[model samples]
Target: MSREFLPGQVIVYPYLWAWQHERGETEGRKTRSTSVVVAVRGANDGLTHLALLAITTQPPEPDRIALEVSDIECRRAGLSDFKRCWIVVDEYNYDVAERSWYIEPDEPALGRFSKAFMMRIAAAFGQASRKSGRRVNRTE
Candidate 1:
């Protein structure tokens, strides 16, 4: 809650909390969720907020549009052992916490998507939003 979050940064948060509230289900315990920050801005109340897309090692569903991240990029973003990763572009959350991010090595916010890749993500998000009438939602 005290640190700043930037777009393109990879972060993990207490997704079990949201899952519990939204679906009343989790893996029988708290589990963290990883996402890539897409945007950051100050809100009316003067709080910093973030927009993010879910990241996963799992192969995305056929209906989902995803960007492939290389192993080097994955390591830079606090993920390792995976030679590749995917960032889902169809849906994302907005106005989430600016802090409480997690990394396995406790490294200094090392996970970040490259500027070029981030631009691609933004473009994809725009296309999907325009076609599907989807908008980023503030985290609950």
Candidate 2:
């Protein structure tokens, strides 16, 4: 994890840990990619767990949902270019905050999406859950 973020928020992150417990964990380089914070749960062990839904500039695939954000919103969120994003609702990941180098809250933040957008995300998540026949947990 390269950047720390709260649940329900959005951020322009630069890398992905690409962790696969079966294979191993491989880290991504410093590259910008958009991700939605799904949760920040605290374990009984006192470690914070982070989950995120990764969004991308790539076109929406079969199960992915498109997210609409305005130009001003994109700029405010620290995107390097125009908005061309989609959500990968079928998949998500979790890690510890200690593994992240999060942009401080005081920094120019990418903040959470609007209520409307969040509602859409939640709805998409539900649909995805049904499509895959798995319960979608850890929603914000």
Candidate whose lDDT is highest? 1
Q: Write the per-residue lDDT of candidate 2 for residues 74-99, one digit (tens) a residue.
A: 55445537555655665555445554
Residue 5, model 1, lDDT: 65
TM-score per prediction, in order, is 0.70, 0.60
Instruction: Write model 1 residue lDDT over 1-140, tens digit each, in one string.
Output: 55666667876643332334356453224333355545455556565665567676779778777788777778767778666678777666555454323323343464777787778878887787677523334443
The best candidate by TM-score is 1
**lDDT value, residue 87 of candidate 2:** 55
- Worst lDDT 10-window in candidate 2: 131-140
Q: Which stretches of candidate 1 lie above 4 Å from their native place? A: 15-33, 98-110, 133-138
